[model samples]
Target: MPQISAFDVVGPIMVGPSSSHTAGAVRLGLAARRILGEPVTHADIGLHGSFAATHWGHRTDVAILAGLLGMSMDDSRIPQAKELADAAGLQYAFQTVDLGDVHPNSVRMRVLGKENSIEVVGASVGGGRICIYEIDRFEVEIDGSYTVLLARYKDQPGVVADITRILASYGINIAFMKVSRKTRGSDALLVAETDDPIVDDVLELVRQLQGGIVARRLPRF
Candidate 1:
């Protein structure tokens, strides 16, 4: 099959006018909000190539800020995302960046709040699709398709199996799983589109591991 561009995707189940540019950006923003773990008071965003050049024409900025505000992708408020963000007292800015060799449609968002500050870099692939290329300066890939589980444990064997077993015991089927590490420590990001919502017990079981530091239940909105 031939390769596809941001404008070539087609679908109706979406909440926006386009999938690749709008929906995908919104998802990225929402995921950023999740990682920040708090309502951001201010933000500085940088867009690359297509995103920086045509974000206004395509509402990419709106979708992005709306995600930070925890708004739905389809919400009409997206059109007035900046205004709404200002009204909500969230500080923000947008700019274009040159990422010569990187993907054409890419963005780096910096957000700040009284509670914390965070930076996230990701891309809108197409058809309102998003992939979190990096978080908190950590390089990892996360497709916002399911409730994601972020785990931190020692660099030992059976860590992956232990996590899977906990989910399996609760009959939770992991739709996707990706693992990464940096020197003595390892990280696991599990995205599960389960038959049932992720209950507390299932989450607690995974948290029981020695190196398990955090587990998040991220549902698609």
Candidate 2:
């Protein structure tokens, strides 16, 4: 079993009927927005397993919409999230889906902005903690425990080395890293959890590599 922390028992300070279904859902949405790194124009949310069944009872729907609007769990406007989203001109829809072999309290968000779009899948693993499992089509594990750098590039030789060199040049130390790809010679993803914040200059350098790269930072909550 996964080790539990003290906060897991005490729960997060949030507007909630339940931590897992409410606060956790909010965090998941925030994580999605963080990945996008811009204002969301549209979102398609899918709830699976237990979240689909008990979402309404816990107001998980509202919590998620509130999150897509960049509202934190403790935001005073959570109760008025729907109105706030409408005021911000954010469009959204929700549906129940069969996300096989996953945690019960899980959701998938397809978020779009004027300049970019992304898909994120995550699960509320009790307390107010969540684990993001997918980004775009790449499978990943992002729990918001630390600052992370997500890099997308062509699956080619020396790409990882090149990116790491940029991080080293910025005096950033990597704590953990994972790589995923659809197939050889296709696109690939690299997630690096860093001990120090990656500066924008380093990110710009990584993006300049190989003429086709996208890099974004995910800050810890």
Candidate 3:
């Protein structure tokens, strides 16, 4: 059994009039930025249900975009986020998407950068808690705690082993993993949540594999 603390019941520390709509949204954005594999160039953001309709009122739009640009909550630029993105040389857009059967406080983002593009979905789960539902096509649920490794590679044998070996070489342990593919022998992203921060050399090893893998590391703070 787990001990329930007063703080856990009272909730998380955050800047907010609304934790689920604001703070959690920011965390979600940062998480997405991490797995995108490179600095963001173009961004197309979509909000669903209640998020689509009322996000602006809650400043969810600002929070979400700020996350992708790697801006902390205290960053002054959050008030004029679109301008900030442009001034900082980041491309960004915001629109609404109907998210069915999922949480209402949700945002999905498509971010483009120098060498890669990615789509990430996350929901603010009240009290500043957020959950990452997917990245591109991989299905996952992230609690915003651990560093993540996102890799795309040819769907063949030994891929998982190769990744595990490389992580083992560096003493990195995978706490969880999710693999996805649209079809057999097609490409896939190996989404891994690790026990500790990831170093760049591990990514280099993954890129060296014959099947070809685009790798990235995301740290959750």
* Most TM-score-accurate candidate: 2
Steric overlap count per candidate:
6, 0, 0
> Candidates ranked by lDDT, best first?
2, 3, 1
TM-score preference between candidates 1 and 3, better one: 3
Q: Is candidate 1 or candidate 2 better by TM-score?
A: 2
Candidate 3, residue 98: Cα displacement in angstroms equals 1.1
What tens digits encode model 3's per-residue C-alpha lDDT throughout 1-221?
Answer: 99988998775666555677777777777777777756788888899887788787778888887778886554556667767778879877788888678898888889888888888888888777788887775777877688888888889888988998999999998999988887889977788899977888998989898776888888875
Ten contiguous residues minimizing lDDT sum, candidate 1: 186-195
Clashing pairs in 1: 19-127, 19-128, 20-126, 20-127, 20-128, 24-128
TM-score of 1: 0.75
lDDT of every model, 2 decimals: 0.74, 0.90, 0.80
Ranking of predictions according to TM-score: 2, 3, 1
Clashes of 2: 0
Tens-place lDDT digits, model 2, residues 72-129: 8888788788888899999999999998999999899999999889999999998788
Clashing pairs in 2: none
**TM match of model 2 to true structure:** 0.95
RMSD of 3: 2.0
Number of the top-ranking candidate, with lDDT as the measure: 2
